[model samples]
Target chain A: MKVNKYITIYKDMVRQIESGQRKAEDVLPSENDLCDQYGTSRETVRKALNMLAQNGYIQKIKGKGSVILDREKMRFPVSGLISFKELSETLGKETRTTVHRLGLILPPSEAAKELGTEADEKVWEVVRSRRIDGEHIILDKDYFVKKHVPLLTKAICEDSIYEYLEGELGLSISYAQKEIVVEPAGEEDRKYLDLGGFSHMAVVKNRVFLEDTSLFQYTESRHRLDKFRFVDFARREK
Target chain B: MKVNKYITIYKDMVRQIESGQRKAEDVLPSENDLCDQYGTSRETVRKALNMLAQNGYIQKIKGKGSVILDREKMRFPVSGLISFKELSETLGKETRTTVHRLGLILPPSEAAKELGTEADEKVWEVVRSRRIDGEHIILDKDYFVKKHVPLLTKAICEDSIYEYLEGELGLSISYAQKEIVVEPAGEEDRKYLDLGGFSHMAVVKNRVFLEDTSLFQYTESRHRLDKFRFVDFARREK
Candidate 1:
């Protein structure tokens, strides 16, 4: 599939920003200059800049042009379907994924419904907790369809199952519908995470789909209340 | 400014969905059919459909084409910067807004910093609570730059300041950076909302910008933990 021109520009600028080629707080080239350089119209350049702004790559200051943001302050964006391993690598932090359970089991009814599987269908259930800098902050319960991911191992879960799914299996994770809510810590959450006396948890319920729009995974990530923070950049409709 | 062709198609389709011209659970026209009807390429048609999916207007099901989701089940989308009035109208519920406070005052340093206003500068501070089904579930604290909204009244606040800003003031709200966190409930939340002994609240901190990229408003929406739900549709980058 061919990418849109504005998206190409957006990705190029994001790469430059993340690579530190475009310094934080430094204003990018004006729309006119970017249009001239990219051989695109000014509107297209603006579109690219808007995408950057919406994704927290840059902030369009009033008098100043699009200026890069302090990327260090922004952690892994919860808006995307990214693995903890990839997020830790992006942040250059020492992170460890401890797989508590990994096996094929009959999924619960809710999980089956979300994954579009039958009641008796076998699915891989992986329970893992992500420790960042020696603090267990997130506990993830993931269920994947057996048809989509036939093989599962604790080692792969400890490392990155997403890497195996995308690299070895060549499966593309396309999109997801995520619901976030705050709930009282359950027994499972208390057992998995070091609660630090927090009574609530930020629960993210995710229904992940593949590129062909097949429901493949259902995950719930519960984070300690005080440690949970979600940041999003959104544009208002015209 | 000229709107993109695909965006126009996307908007039209969204209107159709919201207005019930296309019922929920109904599959939309096939890609080829849409391309033929709109005189556009398949890629452009797909682009429009992707926008619809991202905005929760439709869900692309595997082998079933695009299907309209039950909009009522999906509450206010966390992906867009929308006003309560607009959201309530979309839900078609008898939602009422009660203004608790409306005045111009010196904002706190944090609010001033977020809105990019001087500490000495007067800003409009509005406190309101949303009542849905006879229960107060949300309390909103909004601070706007006085220069942007020179005049304000409790009546307008009771109705919709966003409407007045966009319709009468001709100010186009472009985008916002929002942070969601769970915090212990405060005295203000206890007094304003019927939190029902819940110890925590889901707080949404928003910094809104105008079309010209000027920070104009800072708002904090506090919701009872049990009543809070945030939904978002996201696509992975290839």
Candidate 2:
């Protein structure tokens, strides 16, 4: 494969960042400066920087210069299914769960429809705040069909409820239907996640299924916009 | 099927929106008001509202109440396989393409690598402004392998260059590798697309392959964040 000069420039910048020569808040060289340094046009320089930004190696703040990212991102598979505990474990990151609220609540009409149950159905409501690398990255609100996982509490919420269900209760999860969108962080999210007022969230609505293909749980994964990444592979001829 | 009251409330609200009983920008009742009106808890009330927000029925602004959406959504396929004309046609929305710049230019090193060509290779660079519903929503910069499309021009860029390539030039497109991310609107985009600073752009970068499995085109589709929607299939046990 022919080596691209811009890729060389991109790698060099990555090395600078990884080696701590360029600190997190240090401003990357301007496009014109990079063009002069790399002996390439402004377009080529911008293209290299764009790749860096997309890979989360840098954050390009408009008007301001690009800054090295504080941390490398772990690819969070939003498309495929992975329990929160498993994902955190896979990444080998310091993962902590804080249960803010949990209760037996009456489901609203809309949630009832999604859960394939009746309105006013009693459900286990759990609110969890996930902190990764010491930063609160996700706020999750899960509603479980009471029949599947009954008698939830704040202490149980702090633990992996999915683990308790499948391990202790022997309940099996089958599948889920998820809807993903970009939405702004709301007041409730701001209180827990400390998200900037301008920050948008990657909202995921999932209707979880049981082993028998029954709707058992519904979860909403509100991801910090900058932290969420989804990737997939396809054949060149597929 | 057992009936769920929350779902009943959800359907009722959806009907009100769909039937035009509730106009766009109108605020629904607050959570406290809804709890009393529906005789449900705050969580139950929010359940219905979250559904409304996810399905594009309303916008939740922090501090401000939820505003009903106009529902004039222009859907873009996440497949990333369609040409500009095909995409516009699929959306069934009025879209005009303005050929801002088109010329035979030397490909940058990165473009050459993606195209499987050499650095400084002769390539056709076409810059076009895409207008959806009379508003410029995207500014695209497309690079085509000159070896593939030998005689591309500005006139070709004006109206579905992909159509001209397939119909007249007779080069069949087969597959593509696409990457998408949120990016701040650039100078050219803000100037031409008339987008304000409040929103970002969904930037899609694709590597197009021909019928022979040869990479031939590189396209960047930048869409306004608020207007962008992505839908895909995922299969995994919850």
Candidate 3:
């Protein structure tokens, strides 16, 4: 429901940057050009440009307009257990949430291990579909040990479960362990994703912990192959 | 070139596990069942089953046939500095590496920030296409600051760059800093990935560091939207 015109314009600018149409170090077509192209006011263009600068997408200098920023050495930590809402906010993009399935379910063994609970334990299975840039691309089936999060419903599922957890129940997200995979889209996945044809799925598995490093949730995020990725920064020994 | 046959069968088993057709805790359709279904030998089927058991995909009791593992509590990590080769290997899937583009080039500004090098520094830009389960899903474009890696070529790009870095050149990969983003695909990406009308790309940015935590390489892996993902585990605080 929260939409911003500037963010949309900034996104289009990024497309230009990533595609190589706007080379790194290439000064942008002035805020005036952006305003003209986006058909928005100068203030709106500045807001969008500001978001880009904060996220390291581009840089602006006084009296010189902005220069497209290079993305060479930038990295964000995946070790932090972040909710989609948290991540989307960090990325400065308009994120929309959809609840496909949310209910109490018995923990399957694999899901059980990730949750640090016994097989057959009751867990809150919250299946969330995330939309970024008006595309519903990620299907997240998150499992919370019933002890931590109790009394959930289909309506709560439609909203940010993390918000309900932190804002309503007063819980926090801390540390996490994660695994990544690239696989083919299957029948169950196809039903939800609605891909015209068979597509690959990027499967990410993780164990989420609280600030004190207490394990709280187990999440399996299925990304439409083209939309899921993980980046990192490492130091080299001399 | 080292592909595991047990894994090929395991993938099919995983497919069944995911589909409602195969319920958890229920014993698998027997190694013999698998052999008939997959048209392979009993040994091959057992090996596949063993892999499943090893990765927590299934459980095997000595006298009884293997039990289908429950997957609801699965832990998929979204955060970590993990390698594609390692991920595919862990899943026991056959991952083929394809070189789309590779060469040395000057570090772009954003890339320089990630490489922790000078903006004008030279680096090797290596682009590799990743195929798992016969699907070309990810295109990884890696930028290496010259001091860490002195040589580059299309042939080197064909094999695992990390393999060569660790084995031939001794650039041990200690850890990496990472970030993930969901965005639309650009023209440069379309050339490397056969994205057929797919609209988005998952951009994973990584800066590789050594055991000493010194930054040496920067890689931006672009996952086609349909095939991108991140998973993880977590716990809540009281």
Candidate 4:
């Protein structure tokens, strides 16, 4: 596959920043210098820099060039339907998933409504706590329609349910609608997550659908207030 | 102007939902019936229904039809660089903006770092509180580089700074990077907003750039925790 020159430049710069070669507040070389170095046009360098700025890697100053941004906090992209296992693997951090509960139960009213299932329908409920660096930072409560996800186990819940659904069951996960709000810590959250005495937590509710437009899963992911950060890049519509 | 059939259908359905003709939990007509009503193909009707689902208007069930969703809470699109003025106008509700403070001051250290400006450089500081439905729900603190803005007035801050910047200053607003985090309510928030005794608030920090990729503005929008909700539509990357 032919790669775009600008994307190559962007990836190389990301590598430099991630490897600590480009420290925060350090301004990158001038566009002219980068153009000469990469044998590309000024427009190409600007494209790469724009990507960097959009992804929160750098800040573009009017006259001072692009300065690296501090990326110590984990950046959760708001526009991707990514799984927890996938995200942890990308971070390469010491993470552990503890399955607090895994069972088939009658769907809760809210979950049943969101999943478009009847109240009497059984749903696979999985409650897991995510511990990163020995701190429980996230508590995820997931409900999957039993008609679609017929089989689930504690082992799969501890590992990756998305992997089981997609890789093993061959379910085609297509799109999702997500809502994020700040809510007071619930009893379940307080019991599972090490909230560090915070009174509120960030709740991300997701209604996931399949390729056929069938609602299959409803997830409520509760995160410690201070441990949660969502980053998004938005372009102004003309 | 010519419009696509699917878009026309989508708009018509949106109007129906907005007018309360379709109540929450009401099952929409089946695809075949919608196709006949709109005199369009199944694909076009499906396109319209998909649009409705993606925008949180409805949820599609596997064997059943689409069901309307309750949209009582304001849905803030997480992927748009829209101003609060525009959003309020769209909501068409009783909204008021109060200018708390508007003046030029030395940029704070954090604002200076985000805007890539020196601490000595003066920046236009605008603090405004937003009241919707007779409740003070949001407090916004904005800093604009004086070199780019040149002039800012309390009236502009009270109305809409983006309108003034684009309409009068002739500066093109291009893109923004946003970070959403939950933080404890600060003194300013308590003083300016009716936080309803909530200890935490959702803070959205935006770094806005111009067409030339120059970071010109930094804004911190603080929202009452219970009054904040963000909705997004995401597709899986195969």
What proportion of the true contacts does each candidate reproduce? 0.80, 0.20, 0.50, 0.83
Give the DockQ-based CAPRI class for model 4.
acceptable
Q: In candidate 2, what are the lDDT values of residues A1-238, reduced to their tens digit?
A: 7888888888899889878899866788888899999999986787689667644466666677777654423244444557788777767789899888777777673444456567657787778889988889789988888877767767667777777887888876644555666777876588889575447877777776554445688888887766665543222211
DockQ of candidate 1 (2 decimals): 0.56
Q: Candidate 1 — which residues are off by over 4 angstroms?
A: A1-8, A19-50, A53-74, A109-113, B1-8, B18-36, B39-47, B56-73, B109-113
- Per-candidate TM-scores read 0.86, 0.58, 0.47, 0.74
User: How well does candidate 1 match the true structure in TM-score terms?
Assistant: 0.86
Ranking by DockQ: 1, 4, 3, 2
- Cα-based lDDT for every prediction: 0.82, 0.70, 0.68, 0.83
* DockQ, each predicted model: 0.56, 0.10, 0.20, 0.41
> How close to the true structure is residue B207 of candidate 1, measured as C-alpha lDDT?
85
Candidate 3 TM-score restricted to chain A? 0.60
Residue A92 lDDT in candidate 3: 84
Q: What TM-score results for chain B in every one of the models?
A: 0.82, 0.63, 0.62, 0.69
| Leading candidate by TM-score | 1
Candidate 4, residue A14: CA error in Å?
8.8
Expressed as tens digits, the lDDT of each residue in B1-238 for candidate 1 is 8878798899889889878899977889999999989998997898799778777677787777998765554666655788888788866878888888788888565445667677688888888989988999899999999888899998899988899999999998877778898888887788888898888888989888786666789999999988888988777766
lDDT score of residue A168 within candidate 3: 90
Candidate 4's C-alpha runs over 4 A off are A1-74, A108-110, B1-74, B110-112
- In angstroms and one decimal each, the interface RMSD of every candidate reads 2.7, 10.9, 9.4, 4.6
Which 10-residue window in model 2 chain A sums to the lowest lDDT? A229-238
lDDT of 4 at A30: 95
Write the residue-wise lDDT of candidate 3 on B157-212 in tens digits: 77667778888998667555567766667777777677867766777777665543
- By lDDT, who's the top model here? 4
Model 3 regions more than 4 Å off: A1-79, A82-238, B1-79, B91-94, B109-113, B233-238
